[model samples]
Target: MKSKTPFIIILLVLAVAIGGAWYLKKAATSQGHGAISNRTPASNTTPPPATAGVNGAEPPHTLGPTSAKVHLEEFGDFECPPCGLLHPILQQMQTEFSDRLQITFREFPLVPTHQHAMAAASAAEAAALQGKFWEMHDLLYEHQKDWHEVFDVRPIFEGYAKQIGLDVERYKRDVNSDPVADRIIQDGKRGHYLGVKGTPTVFLNGREVPFESLPADKLRVLINSELSGSK
Candidate 1:
């Protein structure tokens, strides 16, 4: 309820130092869009229990069962190409097992390699505040090329917000708010603590999924196995 505008602006101003180098990197990688999926797969690690939301502060952008026996949680970077590739697969899983599944999306922006990762994460969080997180999430991946290389992605984010029917003013304000940044930072930190080393880290029933067995079909098998065990 309290205003966090002033703090967010100051933080962003400081982050500009990093963004400066990142922007240049973006320009250099302009022709490398299809060169995605270069991420190293995460190691097998114990799955930490996930909160219902990003940080247990704001509600998470979830699809399917609000509370179910099988839960799928993903810690993803919006700017990562592999994450983009896996996004629709997750969507398909949700559609197929809508009644029996619970899916939670958490932000994990890998800022070092992906220049616009943090910005995109914040934009999704802000859109979540406006009840359009899923829309903004999809659009970011759908049109990643449009804003991936540009220096000023805020404008592109604003355009997406507009198209998604979010209030531009509120979206701008919230995207620049400290809470959004906190959510992103905390989520990434949690991912690191949980041994999540890359984009598209998935957990099926609190177990980190091996990348080799992370396809939708395999995930369905995991879910069904859990269901069978629970029953």
Candidate 2:
């Protein structure tokens, strides 16, 4: 009977071990399930407010005639690829509808990713101070690849200023000054007020338009409609 008692004890130990292993496996599975339950897909919600002002209150800054019946406002970043693609379109529009259309250029430099965009914006503002905004604007877009590849913007931009006959010393100082930086910030804030969620957001007559999908012919139609309706 003592020998049988030892055998029973051995069996009992084996049973406990099996039970512990089973419990641990079950517990591990439960934890894995809990972890999976805790995870969730990100939500697509509106971003937080960053500034104050309404779309209409935003000031107009463009090369086109201020009194033109149709006003087109563009909030774009210098480094934005789409903005580069749209540059020629804007130029064509300006040439095609010189008298009736006014296009305003506003700074929306997304500096976090585009390292040189802010500096480019500053350079543009500096040129603007010297009444060469349009000249610099055209040159920047025309030579975006050169500036982006070289990683040296100041020299190239200064060259542009010199080409446009701007006061080179004043241009250099303005580009590095606080006022130019402030102007860029102010434009960004105004864009925020106008619900500008991304670069290349455009407004026509104070109304936001889906310009990415808007073909030139369709845009011309819309412009004509707005012009005729206003009259």
Candidate 3:
């Protein structure tokens, strides 16, 4: 999957997704479709607000209190393979820290690289309209490969919506509506502004952490320390 991506797609995603070419290209280009500049990033110590933000994105799909000491923010593309790998881990974290941790998700669709990214984002947003965003999110990621490269995905999205108990008519209408499209675009733009360059870009307490560096157990330990004011 990584090798199949064209050079341009790698360049575009590099602005925010994890890729080798992205770091090299970032210093050279400042103007393009995925250019990110003057990013503030985030501090590791403090939790960012649930409202407006300067260091990073404050996506609306929060699962805990605005006042929670631990904030885990993920800027992910629905069809990105690495993001799919992180999905189950995130679910486990969400369950384990349901009371003390707040999770915020924002879309960062790699439209140039992933053909169905925008459509998948739209589908999730449509589910969101009916308070079923997380359901659709899980469905899409769980079955990512089934529709990853497929051009026509509306029917698949609609089927998932039905399985989740959403009104199929409304889901279909919302999926094609202006609001859903705009929301996905807005999410991606915000993610780009935060120096997001790939799927599964994560922020812990507003600071971006290396997912590879901190495995789930270590991350859980970090969270516990934060909650205990040990850090």
Candidate 4:
């Protein structure tokens, strides 16, 4: 009877320990779930602002000639691979529809992931001040891989200016100036107001165009239709 009693006490102790452990584990799991629930809900309700401009809706930052029939506004990140792919297409379009189509390039730098994007944008704006925007734009994309290696883009950008026949000293001074930085920042702010959530968002004739499946032929058709309608 004595031995049995000790064994029963031991069993009780073991049961108590198991119960305590299980309670702690359950409490910890509940806390974890509560923490997760406290986090912001994934936003599925609102489509990104950039996408709002589709079906002939205008974005906030409208450039180019107001009278032009077809307006092509492209929101792009400098470091974006898909933007790189679309760059050539934009160039071709610019060449093909030079007379009718007006293109407005807006900067949407994803700075958290794309370190060089903001600098590239600033550089382009600085070049714009010197009447060399398109030249610098082409150089940046053409040598994206090279400049992407360094976080501080001033040196490489200066090299590009030199290569493009821009005055290197003036380019450097302008790029570092506050006005150039302000222009890039304003573009970013405009992008935010326009609901640009990602890289490579485009608007054609005030309508949002899908980035992955941009229908060039359909776009041409739309422009032609607008042109005909205007006539």
The local distance difference test score of each candidate is: 0.76, 0.72, 0.73, 0.66
lDDT of 2 at 175: 96
Candidate 2: tens digits of C-alpha lDDT, residues 113-218: 7888998898888988888888888888888888876767788889989999999999999998887887888788788776676777766666555543345765
Residue 201, model 3, lDDT:
75
**Ten-residue region with minimum lDDT total, candidate 4:** 33-42
Clashes of each: 0, 0, 6, 8
- Which number leads on lDDT? 1
The pairs that clash in candidate 2 are: none
Greater-lDDT candidate between 1 and 4 = 1
Instruction: Judge candidate 4 against the unseen true structure and give its global Cα lDDT, from 0 to 1.
Output: 0.66
lDDT tens readout by residue for model 3, 96-193: 98878888888888878999988898898889999988999999999999999777998888889999999999888898898887777777776766
Error of 2 at 118 (Å): 0.2
Task: For each candidate in turn, give its C-alpha RMSD to the true structure in angstroms.
Answer: 17.6, 15.3, 10.9, 13.3
lDDT (C-alpha) at residue 18 in model 1: 86
Ranking by lDDT: 1, 3, 2, 4
Choose the strongest candidate by TM-score.
1
Query: 2 or 4, which is superior by lDDT?
Result: 2
Q: Which window of ten consecutive residues has the lowest lDDT sum in model 3?
A: 31-40
